[model samples]
Every structure is written in C-alpha cells, then in structure tokens.
Target: MTHHLAPAPLLALTLPSEDVLYAALLARDPAFDGRAYVGVTSTGIFCRLTCPARKPLRANCRFFSSPADCLAAGFRACLRCHPLAPEAAADPCIAALTSALEADPARRWREADVAGLGFDPSTVRRSFRRQFGMTFLEMARQRRLREGMATLAAGGRVIEAQFDAGFDSPAAFRAAFARLLGAAPAEMKGALLQADWIDTPIGPMIAVADKRSLHLLEFADRKALPAELARLRKMAGGIGLGRPQPIDQMADELGAFFAGTSARFDTPLALHGSAFTRAVWEILRQIPPGTTRSYGDIARDMGCPEAARAVARANGANQIALVIPCHRVIGADGALTGYGGGLWRKQRLIELERGYALRHDRQPDDIGQRADGGEAGQP
Candidate 1:
C-alpha cells in the first residue's frame, strides 16, 4: 500500500514552498535542519532536512515544521537522522515541564499553573517554540484532547469526559475533540477493541486490545498517539475503553520489566507492518533486554546487509514499545540517537534494562550491548 503523509499541515507550517524544501532536502542543507523536516511517504519515517541518510523521491516527501507535526501526522522520527534530537528534550526547562504534563495528561494548564512550577510562563512559551515549533500550552492542550477522547472511548458520558479533561464546557470539549481527532466527542467511542490508560515509571501509556492480543501500545503523550488511536478505531470498526485479558497480562509483565525483575513479555502482540518490518521486529525481540544492536546489525541478521536504513525505518515504525524492545537499537557510533518516546525515556529504559542484565549476570559493554559481537541467551 502507498502511504501518503498528510500534506495540508506540512504546507501550512513552512514559509518556504514545497519545491524549496525539496531542494534543501536534496542538498542536505544544514540551514534547514531545525526549520524543516522531511517525512517519507514510503517508509513512514521523518527526518531532519539535512540528514545524511539517503533522501526519498520528491513526490514521496512531505515537509513539516517540527517533529511533533511529523509524528502527529503518523510518521515516526527517523533513526538515522535523529529528527527528535536537539528537541524539547535538549531543553531542561521544557523537559521538566513536559514530563509533568505527560504524567497527568488529563490536567488542564494555565499561566498560573506554569508559574506555580517555578518557571516563567513567557520563557516556557519561547523555549517551546524555539525547540518544538509550538508553544508548551499548545502541546498541553493536545494532551487534554487525548485524555478527553480516551475517557469517551472508555465509556464515559460526554459531560463526565468534559469535566475529567478539565474543559470549561461541553461545546469547548467537543470542538477541541473535532479539531484534534477530526470527529465529535460522541462519535469517538466504540465497543470492539478496548482501550485503557496504563501508568509506568516513564509515563502513562495507552493499550488498545481485544480479547486475544494487544493491537496497539504507545506512550500517552506521543505526538503520534492520537493518530494511532484514530487509525485503530477505523480499522477495528470501533475501540472502547476497557481492560481486556491481554492488557491485564501486559500491565503485569511491564511492571516486572520496569522493576528490573524480568525481561520476558509474553503478552501476545498484534504486530502491524509489512513482512520485512515483522522480520526486523522479531530480531529486536531476540536482542535480550540487556543488549543492543545497530540498524546495520539488525539488517545483517536479516541477511540483508545493505538494508540498514530500511531496518532503522522498521525499528521506528514499531508501536508496541517495550514489549517489542525497539529501545534496544542504537546508532552504530554508540549514540542514543532519536526515539519516538523522546530520548530521555529511551535513556531511562536502557538504564532500567541494564539492571535486568546485571541480575541475570549478562552485563553489557556500554549500556545495552555485547562487546565481543555475540548474541547472549535470552533472560
């Protein structure tokens, strides 16, 4: 299937025309690194315009102003270009505020609330715009919309959801819902696949599943999350809020994994992707929690030595997070690189997994790697 990145918002965000952005991308011009990002329709990945990796065809490229825009349109940050780096994550103030916002995505924010946190609201706005190309309040409002929709999806009354999401009124709530997910709040819920909000040490996660397997698992604050939820709803007929057996099992397994007690995730997954992508995910599963692999390493294991970029694309495409262990993949030069969940969470996950490796007596060379280049047995 041919996937096209959404064009309207991308066009609106850039002052430069698509032709100019395409030219910059071809030239790999550093001048447009932060100002413009290129989303590849074929690979479902977005990269900095100046990324050193191979460029996609002009027809396949969509330009966005920020990583948040790229992900909200359902494109994963490119592993090779580290598009999500030097991101809001690199700013200590933004990082600290976003962390709090992530933990309580349902909470409403105001200038007072921000000042209460010891940050100047004006400074926060400028910093967020500088790094993420949007204001911190804008990001927070997006979270509120997700939380409200999640409530409605989970079977809450519209008024109940409105209040739960801290909105001023039902009209405001419904309007925000329509703007964010392109549907009225009442039209968002269904009964086929069940959705639930799960909390982790890193942050909250949304798990969508049926009776048998997990269909989607992602961080709640992920820019792509709202889009992913909408896609699942359309594909599965409808998704309601409820805890299925698989989700319960997953919650337990995740608890153990994050606590450094176990690395095994036996929660049956509904892996979505092409055959090649599935093969890459399987290799990621074999990577044992405490070890890491480069994209080149994964491609070599798949017997496609020249498909390193493809492997990175597939790695970024994974939505199931920890259960699939995409965090175990890193740059060839031993960098943390980019992560859809933000690099801070990636770093923490690696640190947590290292303890799991140590308990099993399989210490890694740097963080989650084996120096001698031999795969260790599963924990």
Candidate 2:
C-alpha cells in the first residue's frame, strides 16, 4: 500500500513546510522538540529537534509531524534524544513517581510518602503540579477514588469499596466522594458509568462509559477535562471511576488504531448534547478515516451554509476524540483550526490516518501497521 497524505491545506497550520522545518532542525531549536521529528534517511533514525547529536545533511532529512510518523517511515528512535519517550519521561523524578503510582494506585500516599521515596515533599509537589497541573497527593487521592468507584461498579459493598480504596474511615471516604462526585457514596449505587485512563502515543486519555456505550474520550491534559467529567457525572445521575466492559473495548480499539491494524470503531457511543450538536457530530462520523472536510463543507452539507462558525463551535465541543473524527474538520481555507486535544495531536492523527489509507489502498492484503515497532512501511 502507498498511503498519500491529505492536501497540505487540510493539515494543521502549526506545521511548517519541509524547508522551514529543515532550517529549524539545522538550528537545533528547542521550541520544536515536541512539535516535530526529523527522520535521517541516511541513518534510518529519527530524533527530537533538541537532540544533542550532530545534525544530518538537509538532503537526507525527512521531517515528520510526530515520532509515530518517523517510525512509520521506517526510522528508529535516536538514542540521544529518546524520541519515543513521552514528554513527562524527561523528568526522572516524575517518571519514578508515576511508575510507583501506576504500580499501586490504591496506596494511601501522603507527604511523608514522598520523603520516604527519597524526594523532598515540597519539591515533589512543585514538580508534579507544574508538569501535570495537580499535586502528587491529589493524584493519589483521585486514584484511590477511582479504585473505590471501580469496586462499586463491579458490585462490591460500600464498605468494601471504601477500605479497598485505602480510606481509613467511612466518614472520610464519604466526604471525599461527595466533594468530587457531588453525591454521597451510598447514593451512587444505581446504574453508574465508569471512567478510566488509557495511554496513547500522543498522551494519556480519559475514557468514560457505561456497559453499552462510550460517553466521553479526551486527552487527560485538557484543561476542561475535569469539568467535562463532572457534566457527565451529573447527567449520568452517578458515575464510578473504573474499567468497565465498554472501556476495555475502547482500549482495544484504540490500540488497534495506533497500531494501524484498523481505524473502524464498533464500540457503542452514548452522546449527550443538543440536537444541533448531535447532528454535527453524526456528520463528523461519516467522514472517512483518511479523508477530511472543512467546517464550511460540513455546514453546507447540513443545508446551513451560514452556520459554519456554529459547526466549528460544535466540533470543538465534541468530547469523543478519534471515534467521532472531529479532527478531520478543518478551516475553510483547509488549514487546521482549533482542536481541544491540541493542534499537534490533530496533525499527528491526520498523518497517521493518511498513512493507513495509503497502505490499505495499495495493498489490500496489508491491513495496517503498529506504531510500537511493528511493520513500518504500511499504516
């Protein structure tokens, strides 16, 4: 398969042309570290713009919008820059703490815990807050709460949920639950949706769903993510933080998508929005995986040509990421516009889909390519 990217006008505006990107690479600009990746054709390696290694000749360089793109182009990660690592992985302390948290999310983490872990509490707090917009303790608290929610979603007793979540007292657990969920623990026993996190090549994403359908999917770093979850909780009557069947299915589908094996999503969706917004989202779903449409094109298709701005607003409001294909919508002039997940992510997604489309079209037998060091030349 030979995947051809969409026209330049349809990609995000943040990406510079090859010549400009090459100039940035030659200068070794730190500003472009996470924004772009360079694939050295001669060496078959990709590197971050801030890599300390010597620059390759411009003629041998093939600029990519993401590390995934470089990998797709049959390039390996640069040892010096560790281009495959997430941005947060640059901080050893953050990496260690996050690994510990992932290992035991139910642990009752405290300020003393940081001290015991060989980190200054104040320094750890500052670093975590700066990097993730939340204190380490706060993250632990949320993790415990999620565990409790998971227990409840899995049909455990309230007391079991509390203790399982690492809360020492029932009153404390109830108070925390009420504060974050706007409902007492006992009052949340009804059919509740589950919220969980899934890591992607771009970043971590939060997925919320009930047994039947997905409700919300957004990047964890989005500022409005908390508020979006709150809205869903309120609308759902009650929601637990856990891994439900729907979430598992979503995780599998997302894994397949990033791997380039499949772009089609069969997980059911539970959309919550105004009628007009729902209409716009439905149209967005109709967009093919490798194709794109301008906001004006969508609005005009809906027989509301004058409502392009309104359509764009609805596009921004969508919580579901790749599933709804909102990233496929572009500005009238074909430049990438605002996306809640960030323009860089939008660009990467477009490129990924283009790669997949190219592979599928040319080699019908070759379904896709995985980003994690699988077959490179396909999707």
Candidate 3:
C-alpha cells in the first residue's frame, strides 16, 4: 500500500506539496512536528506523521495539516492508540500563571493583568474553557475559596482567613467559600477543591494536577477511567481537585496549533511512556511544525535504521497527539498510512502544513517535494 499525506487542503487549511511531504515522512525529518498530521481513510483513524503502522493506499490516504483541520472535518481520535498526548508540553506563560495563582490563593487576577503578561484575554479565556471547562477568573476564585477552607481547617479566624486570602471584604469571601464547599468559611475546615474535565477532538479528557505539575491526562471514555480517577484521588491526597489551570493552557495551545498560527508551545509536559517510546517522542518534538518524516527514516536517525518497523510501533503506541507529532510520519511509498484519527483528517492536516510551507520561504529548488517524504529520487 502507498500511503501519502494530503497534497491539498480538505477544508480551509492546505496540505504540503506531495513530494516534500513524502520526503519528510520517508526521512522522519521531525522538522514538521505539529504542523501536519496523517489519517488512514481505510482504517478510520488519524495519527501523527510519525505513526509506524503499515502504509495505506494513496487513494485511501488523507492528509490533515492541522488539529483544527481534523476536527473541523469531524474526525474523532483513536482510542487504542491515543494520538492527542504529546511528548513534552512546554507552554511557559500558562505554566507561570498556573503557579502564580496556586501560590497566591488570596490574589485575584484581572483580564487586563493577564493580558499584560503578553496573552490576549480572549485567548486565555478560550484556552481555559476548552481544556478545563472553566474560565481563568472562575478557576482563580475557586482557588481562593479552597485556601479559605484550608485556613479554616487550621483553626484560623474567619475574618483573618478572608483578609489573608487577599479578599477585600469578608462577605464576598464567605459567599465564594459557601459556593464551593457547600457552606460558609466558618462551617468547615478540612474541605478542599479538586480539579478535573477537558474536551478534545477525540472526546472529553480529564486532568488532575496540583501546585507542582500536572499529574494525569486521560480520556473520560476509558474503561479504566474509574481506576485512573482513583489513582489521582490518592495522589492528590487531601489536595482535591481545585481549578484545572494546566488543562486550560493545553486547550489554548492546541486551538492555536489547529488554526495554523505557527505559535510554538511552551507547556511543561509529563511524558508517561517507556524510555524508548519517550525517546522517539522527543525526536518527534524536534520535527518543525510544518514538516514531516517516515518510520524508516526515524529508525535510521535513532541509530537503528533496520528498526524502522520498531519505530512505527512506538509511534502507534504514542498517547499524546499533536505535541509529539506522530502525524508527521508517513509511509515509505509517500501515501497516507495508518492513523488513529481518520483518513479525512490526515489529508486535511497535510494540506494545512503544505500551505504554510509554500508561504514559509522555501528555496526554489526545494519547492518540488511533496512534503510526504516519497519524492526523494523519483522523476
């Protein structure tokens, strides 16, 4: 079977040139990181360009160059092979805001204040809503109320707790405390807030993290979701789920990526995979947003060119999606291949990246490649 990334856009985004895109796939260039993805029409799944599954036919191959392109076309993500989890999350501003809010439970941040930190208010709001299913202000307020609960548990005076939490008035603080803990600040001391919930192209995702770092990222539909939740509950101990700040940041970065803004991500990620898989994922990270590669090429790059099939297996096993960029990997024949998402989405992702590549200042001689990694020596 000859798999190929999309050579044109399925919707608003454009696919990379067939030849150049193929080369990236063949070489597993890692240069195309998050900018492009592939879908297998035959299998009804989408994957990062780095997926190692057997190649599908060109006619059955569809390219999606962006995450938005895939979702816009209505392709669901693959479950057995999770494609949404990326290798390393590196979104700095989001991380910083999350830390600051957690550290100062009493402080309230205004939209303008967040914007002053170099993010558009709308972007921040949207990111939070998509990932954590809440707005920043809402999350922050919840944090404050949780702090009040803790202070109360420690036997602090209600008035002092309110002021210590940076609340201007005791009345306002008490109201918030009641809303979250089901009572006023004076009613309970040991109560706390827990965090969870996020939506993705595949389905609703759940995340639980505290002041330190994000601890878990799992799909809600997983049969083991209950067990996963249990683990989180235990990990958090008494911390409980408060405002999901990290999830919000992920949602925002993903939204921009799908839209093809070329805005690099700086989210701190916790890759949960074997050492080899983690290594493969890291290599995928180095691939530029608008480039691609092949399983064989990736294997060779890793000093095991003969282990191309092994490379593909690792790609198929990737849980994180856009960040690790398995979508950038294609078949040796330059056709769209196996993807956990769907073929239509793959075609669309490729098209979006190619469009960006066309406008990305490539030299004239390099313009002829399809970006699929198949056109290396073909006439």
Candidate 4:
C-alpha cells in the first residue's frame, strides 16, 4: 500500500510578519488555529489561537506556525489548548468515527455506541461539537438528509428515498425534509450537485460535484471558498453536502497524488466559467505534472499574447486545486505569485513535484531557473 505522507508542517520561521500573526492571535480566530501557534514568552508555552487561556500582552506573545516550531524555540505545549494534539480531522478517534458515519450515514448513533467504540460519551460529544459545531447525532441527521436528497436527485421515488435514508415512516422523513430543506419531498427540486469534505495531507478540502463531473475542489481554509460555493449553488440549482460518486473518485486520486505514486487525475470535471477561463484551465491540465507554464506562455499559446493578465485572472478563479494544477502557474521571473491557498502551500507543492520529477528521472519545469539564468532551486 502506498502511504500518503503528510505535507510539510507550518513553521514560524517561514511565517508572515510578527505583527500580522500577533493580530490574528489577539482575535482568537478559529481559522488560524492549526495554521499558527502563539508562544507566550513569560510562561514558555505555545497555544493554538482557539485556546481558552487569557491572551498575553503583545510584547509577551511570540507566534509560531507549528508545534514543532514552538518546541524548537524552547516552548512547551499549553495544557489549555493541547497544541501538540493532531487536528480534529486528523485525530485517529475522530477519523474513525467520521469514516463509520460515512459508511452508514443513516445509522442512529447513540451514547452507548460511542462507549462501545471505547470513547467517553461526553468527551466525544464535546470534540464533535467543538470541531463541527454540531453533535455527532446532529451530523448523522444531516448526513441522512443529504443521502435522501441524493436518492431523490437520482430519480428515486419518495417512498424509496425515505426508506433509503433509514427513516421508519414517510411522515418522519417528510417532517425532516421540510424542516431542513424548506420543502416537502415531493415538491423539492432535485439537486444538481452534491458536496462532501475530504481530508488531505494539507488540510480538509470541500468537493462539490454533479453525477458526471467534479465541479469544485478547494481547501476548506480558503477565504473565497464560501463565495465560490454560493456561486456553484446558484448555477447548479441546488447543492447539498453528501458523498457523491465523483467525490469518492477524487479522494482516491488525491491520495495517490500525495503518496507520490501517481499524478494523473481521471475524475471528470465540470468547468463553469467564461470561454476564455475554460480554455485557460484546459491548458493548465495539459501542462504535465512536475512542469509549469507562465501566464504569458499560456496567453501566447492561446493566440492572444497581450491577454496574459486576463489569463492570470482566470487561473486565480480556478476552483479546483491540485487536480486543475493552478499552483503550477508561476511568475514570468519564475517566482510564485498570488495563490488563494497561501504562498507557503504553493511553494510546498512546487517542491513536492520537483522532488518527484528528480526521483523519477523526469525533466522538471523551469521553476528553478532565475530571471538571470541561474538555478535558484525551490522558491
């Protein structure tokens, strides 16, 4: 079996300016929890942004991007935040429970089931609530709703969908359908796309797809992801969160890519964009793995050399991450440019591909070539 090695951990040595990270720490923003760690010089401990402890003064707070960085700087993990613990999605216990839920979304989960899995009910409840903003039971309910919706979307009869969703009676299923979806099962419109979350080496990603093609694949931390989802929902008529066939295929391909066993993506994609944007994305897919092309090069290939900026805009608008290979686009000078997933991730991806190319005796792209015609290696 090919093991998917995790992405390089975030480290303070490569983080943004101290002032920027300090501000995020002051806000206690949950979005920055795994992306950064706050080290308090006075206490010699580092904590996640979501830590419940009182915030230290700006002068006393030093920021690191990973627990390893904090340890390297002679700081211990804060007991309050348990900074050394794996992220919620990566936690072995949480991962096991989530897998089980995916396998049987309609199964009624109980406190006894949690204990039977060798976990305390209260502890599991708190973990689920904190990580997902809902109890495990609530998540199961939503999963059932999505599964039922998927069945309906696939043209199954109302009775079939209700039973398939594990509902005991049509009345119970109809009540839930109306309460959550604002419509009765018979009156509801079929969803054009289904959404689901997949855990990756970098982070958890949200995948949205129709029956035939993948529509979106983006890191969950992207600031613009919500807006992208809203746009997709409008275009697709309705988008529900659940496992779809395309999502499972994408998860497998992603696992293979991260494991360095393969870079090819066979999952079909639904390109929703202007003609020019679609054309640009198609060119992106043509660029082989371990190789890159600049915006100018893409524009030239499209017979519009002056449209480089427009091409760059289309590249940025790409919703699909690794599969579409937008990270393969670089500056004219061979430097990495703006990436919504963060520059650190862009850098890491380039390095990962370059290493793979070297190991396989493939000719790597020109990312290492400086404007002055010298090798600069990884950016």
Across residues 70-167, which tens digit of lDDT does each residue of candidate 1 receive? 89999887655567665445456787998898788877788899999899999999877654445788878867766666667667788888887889
Model 4 scores a C-alpha lDDT of 0.69
Model 4 weakest 10-residue run by lDDT: 370-379
- Write candidate 3's Cα lDDT for 151-213 as tens digits: 654567888778766688888887865454334544432323244455554334545554444
For candidate 2, write residues 1-379 as lDDT tens digits.
1122333332344466787777777786644555578888777888876665777777887877667678888998876667776445655678889889889988888888889989999888876765566788887887787677667767788899899889999999988766655567676555478766777876678788887888989886666776787788778776765677888898998998899888867788888888888888888776666667778777877888899999988988899888888988865533456677765577567767766666665655443222112111111
Per-residue lDDT tens digits of candidate 4, residues 288-344? Answer: 555657788788888789999999999999998988889877766434567787654
Overall local distance difference test of candidate 1 = 0.70
**Best candidate, lDDT:** 2
Clashes of each: 3, 4, 103, 0
Candidate 4: pairs in clash: none
Clashing pairs in 2: 3-358, 9-334, 259-369, 259-370
Q: In candidate 1, how many clashes are counted?
A: 3
Give all TM-scores, in the order shown.
0.64, 0.64, 0.40, 0.50
Q: State the TM-score for model 1.
A: 0.64
